[model samples]
Target: MAKKKRFLKMKIATLIMIAVMLVITGCSQSSGTSVKDGSNESKSSSGTLKIGFILSQTGTFAPLSEGIINGFKLYLEKHDGMLGGKKVEIKVEDDEANPQVALRKYRQLIHSEKVDILVGPISSSVVYALRDEVEKDKIVLIDANAAGDDLSWSKKSDYVYRISFSNWQNGSSAAKYLANNVGKTAVVLAPDYPAGKEVLRAFKDAFEAAGGKVVKELYPKLNTNDFAPYLQQASAENPDLIYAFFTGSDGIRFVTQYKEFGLKGQIPLAGTLEFGDELITQPAGEAAEGIITGINYSPYLDNELNKQFVQAYEEKYGKLPNIFSVQGYDSAAIIDKAVTEAGSANSEDLIKVLKGISFDSPRGPITIDPATNNPIQNFYIAKNKLKDGGIVPEVIETVENVTMPETSPFE
Candidate 1:
């Protein structure tokens, strides 16, 4: 009996040792990587702030993610790789522009990584998916790009603050200007998505309020191979102008095809900022010329901060920064400012500091509206002009202090 007992004890001790080794090995293999450089520096140190980014690093939204990350890194480089005097560590996850994938990544960032703050997502769908989760987790999320209107309205949360413009702002910014200067009868078009529907609704409301009539509304399925059918419908309606909102490859195809259909000159083309932004206009080339848009940021803006930002961005990335880039830069700026003011990285403190925060951005002076946690800023009515063989937004009129309503129109 004594000999049997000794053998059983030895076997139990050996099994325990193997279990400990397995756990240590698993932890060692799962270390987080730095976003700036793909280095395994995951261990947290005192005075370190962990920021997790959920972005679409693949698929159609890759360019947007690239711009955002580049702009953010530039801010960190300028600030000695610190935010609010705390050393920063970042972890990025790609969502492929899918809401389900974004939610899974969000869980990893929150539960496993234990990130202090969150930022990112190019698509509004991703934003909507992460919204409830962030609120439940009580984590602060700086909305970098998603522009769904409801975010500032019925779905607004204390844990979330948007650093980028909303779809309501994008849609209504140029409505009055176009109605008064361009034409009274218009046909509106956008991709058939939540963003597209919300933007057009806002535009229709504001345009009609400004004594303009929307004679037709067309929504093409996102990533449509050919825009011929939609173009034919718009042409048949024969409105005075066509106002559109399409981004990524869809924007490129629509612009080129609009010109192909010979509707470019016959019917004026106006849209949200994407139509005039380099992302679309560069590829669209001459096809993007004469396109009028409501833009929040342009590399050509004559502002001191914008000038310096443009110079530095071009030096670092070798390209002119777009609206998305500015959004990312502002995201970093807001976090820095909020953390400094709050004097703590806790979500409770950050939330208090984020509300109604104002800062001079590469875009312009931006103030977060306390009521909705949306930006109150300027919008420019710009026309795409080919200057020196490059398309640029030439500001024609400035709409200053554009603000969202205290209550959602939907409500």
Candidate 2:
């Protein structure tokens, strides 16, 4: 009986010891730890900067997302796979241009992967959905392509900063130039979505303010397979010009159908940046020719920085870089700059450094407006002219230092 009791006690002691050892091992494998010197500073276990991208890799926004990812990877390739002088680990999730899917990916990125920075989603709808979540999670999101105007206004969050142009900038940038050069009366068209509505509204306000009139406004459902009906409606209006905003496959189809419907030369076709970008023009071919647009970046820009960028991009990808590509490249550039300046990957540290950050971009010198958290950059009034067997934007006029207002002009 005495030997049995002693053996049982020894077994219990061994089990307890094993349990304590397992707990210690688990703690050592945990995410991070605070400084032992009584300071509140915390550090990650691996000391690697982790970035998560939620992009539309398999939907309408795929091309745009591809450009963004390509540009980001190019930057990494040039910098030895590092950002802010620290090695970067990137995890990309396909949001499929859907908001709910983006939310789920966001959770995985934040909780499971523990990424330090967040980027992307080509859809403005997805950006709107992510705005609240990033704020709640206290993660810094660098907006690569979503351009909804409300992101800089009513729905703005300190946690979110846009590297792409806003709908307001997109719509209004060419309004005055087109109103003066193209015609005084125009028909405006965009898909019936938040970005579409905001863009048309901006164009309308600016065009009217510049003494021009919008004769009619057309809102077609997104991804309209045929723009023949809208083209007919705009043609029937007999306006001086037609201004439209469409992107991705929609942009390609609209430009092609606009020419097929015989409204290309009869009524001047003017549109936002996407109309002038190579993504649409290369595929649309002759149909995209002679269109006037307001563009933020083009491979044809005359500058040493842009020339180098074009050469490097072509050498690597065997293709020309578009505005979406510039947005992606600048997205990585801003992160590298911010992280370096902040000296920490924490959201709090990055936010402080990102405000009013300025850098020389392939587009031109770009500054983040401290007030609106939107980019203050240049807009080019360009006309698509065929050269070298391809359509390229010919700069007609340069609008410099185009800035977004701190408050919504609509409000």
1-411, model 1: which lDDT tens digit per residue? Answer: 999999999999999999999999887656442211212133333578889999999866788888889899989999999998889999999999899999999989887887878998889998999999988878889999999888888899999899988999999999999999989999999999999998999899999999999999999988887999999999898788899999888889999999999998899999998897878988899999999999999999999999999999999999999888888899899999998998877777788889999999988899999999999999999999988998988999999999988886755
Error of 2 at 259 (Å): 0.8
Candidate-wise lDDT, in order: 0.89, 0.90
- Candidate 2 residue pairs in clash (backbone atoms < 3 Å): none
TM-score of 1: 0.89
Best by lDDT: 2
- For model 1, the local distance difference test gives 0.89
Q: After superposition, how far is residue 229 of candidate 1 from its true place, in Å?
A: 0.8
The sequence of per-residue lDDT tens digits that candidate 2 reaches over residues 1-411 is: 999999999999999999999999888766263222321123332567888899999867789988998899888888999889788889999998889999999988887777888889788999999998887877889999999888988888888999999999999999998878879999999999888998999999999999899999999998799888888899998999999999999999999999899888899999999999989999999999999999999999999999998898999999999988988899999999998998888788889999999999999999999999999999999999988899989999999999998898787
Runs off by more than 4 Å, candidate 1: 1-45
